[model samples]
Target: MTEAPSPAPVRIRPEIAALPPYRQGKQAGADAFKLSSNENPFDPLPSVIEAMRSATAVNRYPDASASRLRARLAARFGVGIDGVHVAAGSVSILQQLALATAGAGDELMYAWRSFEAYPGLAAVAGATAVPVPLAADGTHDLDTMARRVTDRTRLILVCSPNNPTGPIVRQDDFEAFLARVPADVLVVLDEAYAEFVTDPAAVDGARVLADGHQNVVVLRTFSKAYGLAGLRIGYGVGHPRILDAARATGIPLSVTAQAEEAALASLDAEDELIARVAVITDCRDRLAAGLRAGGWNVPDAQGNFVWLATGEQTLEVAPRFEDAGLVVRPFAGDGVRISVGEEASMPAILEAAASALSLLPEGHPARAM
Candidate 1:
């Protein structure tokens, strides 16, 4: 039966109404390698699976504070119990931090082409998003980001090994940038991919926090390195007061008991989990090197992904990879991000990248010098 068309959707914030919903990585067909999300290609540890099985208490709500998981993370980072907060995912913590710090008329600043969720989080808080464009090599131009800050700026996000385009913010550069930012302004070091980094010069957020960056927060996740993406658990380490503010904004009991148990188990099995990360990073390096050898200007990828700055050709180039049974993430008019997927997918990736490279116009920036 034809019903009255739902009266133009209920009134909502104009900014949020204007914003686009967050888009996830495309799912691949059964025969295709899903390289769209920068996810761990490894299977979960049996220990983690067993923990989840034992944690089956769907009939009851989870611990609101996730105390045990928080305690473990706190001990690992030498932080106080109150200073550690666990949430559904590190991305959820980002939104919590945004809501806790920024509001209407305030500003949430970050690098462009970062995690796609950043803008929507800011909009949800009724805060203005100030996105500083990435440098030509797709790294954050911290100097300019610091300059962009003003009295209205309440929060800043620094995504190391910047997503989509891979490059870590060097320790020297980050410290210099931090010095210029006001002490009151909160800076979140989004290190979801920290485990994959091999660069000695990269800014280790844990070290930076220990060095006493009072306003700094370090966010990490079991979703990426620990293969807990399906479980949805991550943690944040920061000043107790800052974490308290974020904790207050969180939805009670959103983190499930199963997720918490899997996280604890993943922590117990961290050594083996990290070895899997090493394999992915090794694969990432090989992929980046192969792309470079083929005259594609791949960045010094420290994450489990490689960026193909296909530029304006993204729309045309991404589908070619898809045709080769590789589903990749493409940011139209910007570039394509190809995650380092299963080892079996490597040959397809290289072949697709080589073909995409041949499709680029003469003198495209993505072409090697």
Candidate 2:
């Protein structure tokens, strides 16, 4: 028999070991209401499910390029086919971008605590991470971010309608921010929650790209808005040459034929799917208003969820939420982020928020400064 390797002999990369693992949603039991992970609560579209069922070509590998999905996306975005490349998910695409572009003494800049993966991806790719702090309003401090940029900075990430902090960077501000930054550095506008936004001035990465900016690449996924969290499909669009470069590096990484079929069907049902998003937008607004009424530090969110800027207060009150059968997302020391799903998680969540207000320690900041 082949000998089993000793644990000590496995000289793994220290950077990998030093990394804090990504925290997923908490699981209570079979009947728990999980609002922890920001996934859409709806079932997959009938069209999407049917596509998956018909895609039984499990005998073969997926197309490395994911051409059909790309074509569909191009039509939707009104971009050339060469401008899009689909991958396992936007998070996967982000990691690959960090590897392919930013590395070896280069610096990767992004808002602090925006996406946990930013630093991990930077470390794995042998790059320096410079985390710019968010504004007191819990939005990207674009001016400060622009000031923090240096020649060594190889990549800049802008998360519109930022996760955990629901502020959308205004388009005019981003255009100015884009103007200030050096073009050599690849700027990634992560629009994972793009479909949920209803703000008039919100920075739309697609519109920005269509404006003919060369180095700006936009990342989006089917996980959130499309209700396809299980599929792990995402794409990026940019200058054809730049996107093509990212594509060339993304070979051998894609979903099965089943995933492709489902994605195609999802595209066909976009109008219906978007109508579903309208409901989520409503929920987001109602919850934000409700949280404010209960005396929590809730922001004016534009995405599918509202965030509690309660800081340490969240830690103290998180258990109360658990007791109410609502699983909320708490970032240990930073704050709490809750995903607004259906009417079910709301009553329990609101009750928990009320309890949280009373249970929290004195002198905790009640709202964002």
Candidate 3:
């Protein structure tokens, strides 16, 4: 029998057609530790679980506005209810803000090697992505970033404790950078891993917002610290007008009732949740110390992950981790990111990292003195 011919591809935006889909971290098998995604290894508190279980009314659409959750967040952040906006996740809010602020020919600026989603968010809004390379130490060079801002720039994303590479932007540096940015241009401080930060000098988005930076919006998530990754809930705090614009661009009812309930429960259990974060941070510090002791030049890991700047050896070293019952995130030609998992996983992680360090040349950048 003759084979049928394939149908013609449907028309779509060429830029989008050329864009690569967001790649999730690799999954691990039964015997392996999944340290690819920077997920909280702690189990959800019983209160949060109960809250989710109580949200049994699946027959009804969620509050389109996510009012109660917004109110709770507003109170916590000392902002008016309108100043807070809830969404399926902080990334969803990012896309909404991009759509609200920029379009074709406009520019959305971010530090490259930060969040992997920033460029895709810009592309989805039909805006050009302006990725400023990170400094030699893997932190955002805010001075250089501020200098790069142009008239066409409509949105700037600042990721603290930046993903993959983990150093944070200092508060003083962020303030200086903000001063240089045009007031009309929106700045979204993506603080997805804010709760994990232990540095006293790291930029505090809430403090910035409270200081009357009306052009700035703070994006945070329940996914990381709260162990609500499966629930898909997060919020943005900013001027009411700015949040309103984001709301205009958002999909109505995207934040589900269960997610809102779970978020509320997490907030109620903030003390307990924060205790868990301390444990994770301790684990993170130990992991970083272990990697550095192995002669690997690990960055200042403020997030729950350590970066191995494997450079060209990223692809080659990733499987070595997999063979040792660990799954990690690897950026080809750049580096590998290993999340701080259970304390028990640390021995294997350190062992794998030490073995991988031997593959680098004598004077590689990822090697420490």
Candidate 4:
């Protein structure tokens, strides 16, 4: 007998139903290096771990407002307590901001090949995602982004040291871009990897906010530099009214007590964490330099990762690195992004990069002249 036809699936928003879930970096085996995710390679400080241990009151719900952590961040950023909003991660803030600012028929704009989550976030919010292509050098084409702004546009996301591509939005350029944007449209500067940026000219979100750009909100995370990826603590610094709107859209009590405790401890140990960031930045620079020396057109890598523009060969080239025990994030038909991992992983990374370079034609865009 033939099986009965399956019942119609429960109604999900068509966009949500069609949307792909966020893809995480591929994990590696015990002996292999897992550099797919741009994670801090260092172990948490003893103080941070101790702080987490002290937060043993899991039976009780955490502070729904995450007041202490918000207070700390506010003081650090020299903002009023209400000016800071803490959440599970900076991505959560992005979601909240999208919900707060845009809705069905509204448009949310950002640079293409950025954060990867931007399109999904806009779709989830029932907003249209307007992605402007990156410039040839893998940086945001801010001028094009400004020109594309429509009256329906409600929110914009700017990811600096843009994910996968590894180039930053410069300060002067960012300021000029801001000037062209209408004052009513909200701009969210997603700076998840800010700590890894060593360039003197990269846009500093703190400085931008201090300059009183009311339309701007700077989102940062403890995930990258502080080794708190698992805890998921991140925050946004902006005008209180804007943050309040985002907070209203957020899920209450999502930031756990352990995460708050750990974040506070991480801040207390800032000097040590900054030093670790320096090491990773140095490793990133060396790795990029090595790739360039081998004739690969590596971009100005300001984050804890470097990009290899393997183009149509991305799928084929990624396996070469995997075979070399390096798990990297490959954007099919685009390129590969290998996070700057431990110093010990450098040799294998460089070797894999060199092999990938060999697959390119003599004068491909990914090759240096």
**Tens digits of per-residue lDDT for model 1, 26-55:** 998899999998888888889989999997
The window of 10 residues in a row where model 3 has the poorest summed lDDT is 4-13
Model 2 gets an lDDT of 0.83
Instruction: Kindly list the per-residue Cα lDDT of model 3 for residues 173-234, writing each as its tens digit.
Output: 99999999999999999999999999999999989988999999999999999999988988
lDDT of 4 by residue, 29-119 (tens): 9999999999999999999999999999899999998999899889888999999999999999999999999999999999988888999
Candidate 1: residue 283 Cα off by (Å): 0.5
RMSD of 1: 2.5
The estimated TM-scores of all candidates read 0.97, 0.94, 0.97, 0.97
After TM-score superposition, the amount by which residue 84's alpha carbon in candidate 2 deviates from its true location, in angstroms, is: 0.3
Candidate 2, position 207, lDDT: 88
Tell me which residue pairs clash in candidate 4. Answer: none
Q: lDDT of model 4 at residue 309?
A: 86
Query: Which runs of model 2 end up more than 4 angstroms from their true locations?
Result: 1-8, 251-253, 367-369
The C-alpha stretches of model 1 lying farther than 4 A from their native spots are 1-7
> Model 1, poorest ten-residue lDDT window?
4-13
For candidate 2, the TM-score is 0.94
Per-residue error (Å), model 2, residue 69: 1.2
For each candidate in the order shown, give its overall lDDT on alpha carbons: 0.92, 0.83, 0.93, 0.93
Q: Which one wins by lDDT: 2 or 4?
A: 4
Task: Give me the candidate number with maximum lDDT.
Answer: 4
How far residue 29's Cα lies from its native spot in candidate 1, in Å, is: 1.4
